[model samples]
Target: MKPPQLTPAALAQIRTLGSVLRVSLEPGGGCGTAYAFALAAQPGDLTHDLGSVTLALSPEVARVLTGARLDYGARLKPPRFRVLAHPNTPHRCACNRSFGVPFPGRVTPECRAYQPMLWNLPECP
Candidate 1:
């Protein structure tokens, strides 16, 4: 599968964060599942070279992230990263933190708190 594409704005933010961008899967209790993104100091076997930056992903993470796109929206208050065309995630909880991959699960209180912050997020096509 093709590696995720990062926008120039996202690249700039990632560059400031660290040399390597790591993508991993977070397994929740029961059938819940989520994706996590972080900055690493170095690259590993799962890393993808993106010219200016390296995006690291485990084999499992890469499979689920196929066709995903990352971008940054500076205009949004507080400024944040956005995901576009996330084919693997069919339903994201109102929180925007956890997603219903293949199926939806119970919503946690923490997720509910983030519901108000979910506006303007681009939906999966």
Candidate 2:
């Protein structure tokens, strides 16, 4: 299968910064988490190397990003990489910094198996 592709604009942005794109997950809001990308100089365990900029992502994030096109757009003050033609069709927040989880099932084994101590901890701001 062909690897996921990043647009020329996106490539240029990454190259301008001279760093690999590190793809990972971050808290969106409430209990949801969203895909995140940052600039890094080194590749992580799960990495997809492009000619100029490498993509370092977790296996799960990579799975969700399969066949997606990465592009740069002007939604916010600074243009940012946006995933286009994603299979899951996730919902995005007003600010575009966060997105809804695409998983259909409401719960996961990780949540189901959360330790009691975690539940007793104080809420985070």
Candidates in order have lDDT scores of 0.63, 0.57
Candidate 1 residues 1-125, lDDT tens each?
68889988889988887767787656452335566677772333377788889888865567667798988778877687667667766556655556644322332434322232222222222
Best by lDDT: 1
Instruction: Report the lDDT tens digits of candidate 2 across residue range 1-125.
Output: 23468888878888887758776655553334456777862333377678767877654466556687887775655667777656543554444444454333331223322222111212222
User: Which pairs of residues collide in candidate 2?
Assistant: none
Candidate 2 regions off by >4 Å?
Answer: 1-3, 29-31, 41-44, 89-97, 102-125
| Candidate 1 Cα outliers beyond 4 Å, as residue runs | 28-31, 41-45, 73-80, 102-125
Question: Which lDDT value does model 1 have at 50?
Answer: 87
- How close to the true structure is residue 58 of candidate 1, measured as C-alpha lDDT? 62
Report the alpha-carbon TM-score of model 2 versus the true structure: 0.63
Tally clashing residue pairs in candidate 2: 0
Instruction: Give residue 82's lDDT in candidate 1 (0 to 100).
Output: 64
